[model samples]
Target: MTFTLAIVGRPNVGKSTLFNRLVGKRLALVDDQPGVTRDLREGEARLGPLRFTVIDTAGLEEATDESLQGRMRKLTERAVEMADACLFLIDARAGVLPTDEVFADILRRKNAHVILAANKSEGRAAEAGLIEAWGLGLGEPLALSAEHGEGMAELAAVLTPIAEEMAERAARVAAEAPETDVSVSDEDDDEAVRKPTRARPLQVAVVGRPNAGKSTLINKLIGEERLLTGPEAGITRDSISLAFDWGDVPTRIFDTAGMRKKAKVQEKLEKLSVADGLRAVKFAEVVIVLLDAAIPFEQQDLRIADLAEREGRAVVVAVNKWDAERHKQEKLSELREAFERLLPQLRGAPLVTISAKTGKGLDRLHAAVMRAHETWNARVSTARLNRWLEGMVSAHPPPAPGGRRIRLRYMTQVKTRPPGFVVMCSHPDKLPESYSRYLINGLRDDFDMPGTPIRLHMRSQAEKNPYKDKKNWGAPSRLRKHLDKPKPKKG
Candidate 1:
């Protein structure tokens, strides 16, 4: 029963500030520079009793061509079309410029529900602009200062009736709907009883170097041009998330900006964008490192994929633009070899070949993502792990450091979701990194966990003792001390 509200305005008009206030978090990147935001970012907005989805969109620009600004304008217009209401914000200090008038007309024609507001209306200097905002012909413009948290109560008051009206309309529609009878078989009833409750959506992130088709791939997967895509290298500047259903599985997919090397990321906005993308990778369960097939596995691509592996997320390397390549088999072979050689930590990970433009090979990509997720969450039983440890230790015993054998005692899985294990062995500090890698590789191979990072830790047997650090050595309990006292009756 919730509605969606989109905050629309030119660049540097406090849209992001108001969005952060409503969401109660700094979800969007805000800066004094114009066009800091380039994607449509959605967040759950809470304003008093009214709850709705709020989309923070790119600024409205006067461009119709296929330039970057034009594409951004198109994206913002799309948001306007989808949103239930549009909050048209104008800078009060700057007053209503020609750009503001142009976009106001655009919103008037595109969206029926529009709330005009004059932002930065906290001083006498803004009085003229506040008075001028009414001429836009939408309605009475509220004086708002997003930075100072003014006029929020008025905004909430305006939104309350709209929310109530929508709710009532929805309830009336439900009441008018006819009821249908459904028959359930005994097997169906049993199946329903065995079904698990609804769970949270799976998180997936698509990351790669500039012009590697990350946005294009996501748009193809979602079956819509929801994201702004072009031949531009850095068209996206925010890690935008969209909720979608991938074949019965609820998923939240993140489309991140292209991440260049540190030296090339000199611009403040680009650096912020890269940091935001890195955050997305850390939050995701499975990460798809998209690479251009023409030049697959570049240094930056390897670094991005390695970062995902280091973050302990499931890694899926996808070579995009396969349809444009002439020799598919040869190119794919080269990609596989390069992947295995360049990123040994993510050994045996899924390397999927996809054509993001033509929408070919997405099914394989989806399968690989699902498989990697399953392997990442794989857990082995304690008994099986111990037995496997025995075989591994017997096959190649631990190296003797200082002429002393490092005895391996037991092994057990400590956690899953990237599958962590702890092995009890003598002189864990003496265990070599090569030996740890050997054990981790063995675990991966034995448990059918491929491409998922595995954490193997060693612990000494003494560390397992519960009373190792008890005070007063082996002092008796109070009751035992009283019982052991001299027998006064016998005396």
Candidate 2:
């Protein structure tokens, strides 16, 4: 179960900083300038064992209800209402002002679970402001330095009980009415999974560098001239998504502007177009990184692929304009090698060579997409996962560092929809990148999972295991220990 928390405060109170601290990443852009974050950015946050969805809202300011700032405040209020709890941040250095009081009144009227956080409280300078926070009447204020991470443990303690309560309630609800998948025939499945009738169609965004045949390919797939296409570059300005069906699958396809080198994009519209395209990529479940066959792997193309990987979205590489290439066989082989060399993170990804203009390999492209999507949604049983882990360990044993061979004892798929696996092992942080890649590639090949991105996370089990002291005993541990142990004396 997951709960939602909204971080609300006036401008430049380090809301974004606190958000980055909670999410354990700099996902929200943090700038010293006020109002840098104008929109609400959400991320999965974790503190110790507590996990929840956290929203970083835009800073509030005084304005009329019709003004932009007023609208942003309304949005923040809506977020506060939707969240199970709210983290009301105040800059302890700046001290409590009228804006903070006004927001405090608003929060009090809402009667939401508010955790007053006194940010920037690292030194004597912030002491008076921290004392002033008591006037808000919310509760005991948590003196925190979001940037320096001074009081995260205290904040986590406050949030843990609320999170546990929400989790328990969710468990009860889930227990009362368990969800079961009801398989339906293809014909019936259409109605069951139709966009308008059922859930919203999965959004898929096709993005790449300029002249990657993005518009042409989208037209080919939709079987219509929905978007303007030409040999000239920069034809599409806005990122547009169209709803269509491929066989039985209902999908929303986003045709985006040709992304160029940041320096090359000078015009205001072009900048907006690029931003819109990125928004599409962020929102989409899967993104197809279209590469022009002529220039298969450009620097920008690799950047786009890296961005998708960083964003945790499933990706498929489509080599567009394949029919136009004169040296087809050699070029395809070269492209494959380059893909392997450049974007190794997407190793074993689906790379389909298709002519968007001629529609030569449309069926193959669709099949590749469907296969990748399935792999993205793939889940493996615990028994099968352990068996695969055993095989992986046997193939290429982890190298010993400091006379201790690393042991990977257990593996489990933590989440799917771009399957993420967690492997419990000794010195998880020390696991070589090459070894991790080997495991991931093996999983892809063994499971017939192609195209979709797979995440293999390693976690240390230092104190969790009770048999750490007995290095040479215990049957269950001995079995795993033997796998890594050097071959017994040949004699």
Candidate 3:
């Protein structure tokens, strides 16, 4: 029931400035350049009592076939269609230009509810341009300085009515719907009843190469002698799931058998243990891939991370035995750089250095797990997604091979257990693997979906069948005709 407002305009019109003002945070990277924000950034916005979703779009510009601008235009159009209203921003000091006119035309054609905002209207120089904005035919201009935070009260007044109407309509629609068992009940308002039904504690499987301090780290996090501690490789045979809480958060820690090269894994029980550990990864929401601080970023460690990514699980890297190591700073930095370079998919992923024996950095490790879990459940609005998509297309337009440019129509998140998305397009098969990687990287960087695997699927328009048109699908026409023929003259 959230009313969505998209701030859209040509480059350098202070859209990001206003976004920072409304969101009340510097979430979007702001710069003086026209296209510093090459992604659609979204935040929960509040203007007085009004609460709605706000989207910041990239700077609009002209584009040629297979050019970035063209892709950006397509992205913006999708955002406009998804939004309930749009704030068409104009640089008051610069006055209305041909790009503004073109965008205004586009907004009008979309029939989206719009408010014309003349940003940077604090000084005397902006007065004339603010007056000139009235001719854009988008009603009275709301003149305000995003940098100085002027005219926010007036912006609230403008948005109040729209917000109220949207809220009321949503309530009415919700009132007509049937309720389910999971729906909150008035009688179950007490603390005991309100507590979330905790599922079977998350099954976490810690897997890495031999002598990776898997048992030591597990013992340190749980503060118990649950697993046998030894310097010998492969001390544990079977994968074990132990119930424990990490700072009030319930967790099931699985100490698994250490994996080695396939040629070295000769024992029958060892092979079974490896398969069992992998199954645990598939079931887990968050997997802590422990690495020895001395030999961090080994090929085996990369393979473990890749497996976790492929399995669509949240991952956190814990560089253990840091207390005993010399040159700790250098090693930590090296580990981080290698992570970024080798595993671009897990951008912004948490990397913690800890001493398993001393329990150092365990608090940070726990925090990282919680953060990764939240990001794994994150959902983006369709409007904001399209806006971000537009910026990406503008930055790097999709490739064309045979004079026919690829058209990415729309993207919608179909599932979120593993954060899967489906992008509807004209030619699903024609998209290159590199382009898919590019989009995935953008998603990870912009949305803060680090240390998690994201699934992107392309679907063709021709494959969809909405109506299910088929002969004799419902009631036959002959049966309807017989019924209409007066019941066979009353028999």
Candidate 4:
């Protein structure tokens, strides 16, 4: 609920650099490359005593409808509408271009409160270019250098008053708000709140390799050109989150940058983009790892699926560009084989084939996502788990190491949201990895938790009886002491 300020301008004009400076972190990927940011990324920004929300948007570009740049422009305009103020940046070193002049008017028409800044105004050489920026008719431009940290005090002076006003309003509203009390049930897990919320939107992140139609899929879902899509690869550089409803379920979906192999990812900017996509996976409740149907289950795709599994996220494999495939049956077979063969760790995950461009098979994908989410949050009672454990162990006895039988005494469900269980046994270390997999697979099948990650830990303990671990197995008790007093030896 903080005050929001958005950085707006053409590409490669130090907008992201300034955003990073204000946020005090390298949250956005910054490089000399133009059009690196295709979506708006939000962060909590701080400059001196001023604190507010900051958004970094894609550059303003003019293009026809259905084109990528045009879509990016539309998204940026949406950001302008949401922000309290806009910092319109012009590159002083490059001087004002025609696009800058055009966008200056656009910002004026689009937003009421716009602050103009001439960035890269660090050295004397930029003075002439800085002077030229004033001709755009956005009042006198604030001379600033985003990279060199100059003119920040001036920027702070202008923002501090605004920040203070926002703070006072927020405090007043909070003070007037009423408080409510609610009871938390003891039967439910304490971390139930951490699981996916029913009232809130379902957070789903669609991520995959470059040009796999991630943006296209999101655009199809929203029935608008909400994201930029093109034949070009690596168009999406930020994990853009959009909110909408699928059926009755409100959903928040993230279209992330395509993940390439670590060897192919060399640029500092791309590395940051990949990291941002990875972060989206961690935050998401259900992650749809999109794949190119024409060439599905590539090495990178396997790695992405593995990463999601390692994070314990509910996974759905979505093969995009399905309409482009020539051999439908053969391709489907190939996808299935490759998915199960390459990513065995994510066995039984939903493999949904869809054409993001044509909007084909989306319903199936939606169903799969919903199913995976339900399974991820699924829980089983301790009595049920213990009963199932006994049946499983009786069917396939655990390995007897060194003639000592590894007795699995009992098991209980420890948690849900990727259902975790702990099994009490003798010599837990002696339990084989294969047996652990067997138990996990059984849990998945018996509990109807397909595609959801399961955690099982074997903990060692002695027999539950109080005298089981006690010494004196051959010694007589007090009640039998009189009868056993050397009578056997005398006979």
lDDT of 3 by residue, 1-491 (tens): 57989889988889888988888876555666566544355678977777888877767887634455555556566677778889999999999998888889889889458999999998899999898998999999999899999988999998887888888999998899887656465565433332223465655678888888887788788875545556667765445566677777678777777877778888665676577677768878888898988788888888888899888888888888888889877877788889889987787788988888888888898888888877776777888888888888889988886877887878888777578888877777888999998998889889888877889998887655653785334557777655556544564
lDDT of 2 by residue, 327-422 (tens): 989998999899999988888888889999999888987877766666667788889999989988897899888878899999999988678999
1 versus 4: better lDDT goes to: 1
- Model 3 per-residue lDDT at 128: 90
Better of 3 and 4 by lDDT: 4
lDDT, candidate 4, 1-491, per-residue tens: 46889899988898889988888887788878898888787888878867788889998887748677887888899899878888999988889999999999989998877889999998888888888988999888888988878999999887776677777888999899887546665576644555445467789999899998998899899887767678889988888887788777778899899999999999988898999999999999899999987778888988898899888899999988888888899888877887778887888999998988889999999999999998888878889988898899899999999999999998998877677899999999989999999998898788888888898999988756766676554456774666555656664
| Residue 323 local lDDT, model 1 | 90
Candidate 3 TM-score over all chains jointly: 0.55
List candidate 4 stretches off by more than 4 Å: 1-5, 22-25, 44-53, 61-85, 92-99, 120-132, 143-200, 325-330, 463-491
Per-candidate local distance difference test? 0.89, 0.82, 0.79, 0.86
Candidate 1 structure quality by residue, lDDT tens digits, 238-344? 89999888876678899998999899889888998899999999999999999988888778998999899999999999989889999888877788788888999
Which pairs of residues collide in candidate 1? none
CA-RMSD of model 1 = 5.7
lDDT of 2 at 64: 48
TM-scores of all models? 0.90, 0.55, 0.55, 0.80
- What's the distance in Å from true for residue 233, model 3? 1.3
Model 1 Cα shift for residue 115 (angstroms): 0.5
The best candidate in terms of lDDT: 1
Error of 4 at 272 (Å): 2.7
Model 3, C-alpha of 329: deviation from truth (Å) = 1.4
Model 2 residue 55 CA deviation in Å? 30
Q: Which stretches of candidate 2 lie over 4 Å from their true place?
A: 1-198, 463-491
